[model samples]
Target: MITQLPDDFRFSGPSMELCTLTVRVADLADRFRFTLVHWGDQLGPATAMLVKLESGRDAALTEFRYAIERHGMKGPVVEVEAQDVAAVGVAALVDDVLGALRLSREDTDWIAPAENKARALDLLHWWAQTSWDDMHPRSEQRE
Candidate 1:
């Protein structure tokens, strides 16, 4: 599914304006692929995250979609805009991704430069592993 960010969804940050954010989900044989496209001049390149689960692909997709729907526009598309919004949509999505994969923050890698494609894939691999628990444990509670 693709969701277009509202034109009014503005936050102070990058010098470039955000044109659109395309979220694509594909169900593969063994895993589900999620691609987030930040389309704009200087917004950054697109990134893909792979998620593999023994079961509950539907549930994971549902939760992920919910996260995007709920907080996708609450913050900026990049980290530079973190100061303006108390809760970043990207951060929230990270939390949701971690929750869905049953992984901790330290367990996964993140896009450091905010536009690194390799690092983004690394992040996906680290978080895509199966967890021992069936339900997602909150990050705060994990510690």
Candidate 2:
């Protein structure tokens, strides 16, 4: 299933825009496993983050781990679960990522601040752009 986020939906950061989310359920070990991809533009073309959620009744289970593949290398994975994560929190997390655009390790700068800041801003700028143009024609265009 594909879900298109609101067109006006956006935040500031250096990841990428919150594009459509694709969710697929597969039979893994006789149990259904959900594979959700947050598709959007990065440096070029588009990129995706592999999302996984641990099953639980508590809304906290909505917290998911994400991995981004850059140049065949997977970036660090982090846990991002918050109270505002509704039923479609996975999609919301995409916006959160785009808004913050900070990796798990980058939460703090123990090393060079200048270099890290530049990199973070670059990622955030690229991610902060809108993905409305990338959407299909059938998508609803809400002003």
Candidate 2 local lDDT, 42-114, one digit each (tens)? 3433222233223321111111223223432222222232222323344445434333332233331121222
The lDDT, on a scale of 0 to 1, for candidate 1 is 0.32
> Mind giving the per-residue lDDT tens digits that candidate 1 earns over 57-82?
21112113333466563212222223
How many angstroms is residue 101 displaced in model 2 relative to the true structure, after the best TM-score fit?
24
- Which regions of candidate 2 are displaced past 4 Å? 1-32, 44-72, 82-143
Total backbone collisions for each predicted model:
0, 6
Error of 1 at 91 (Å): 0.7
Candidate 2 matches the true fold with a TM-score of: 0.20
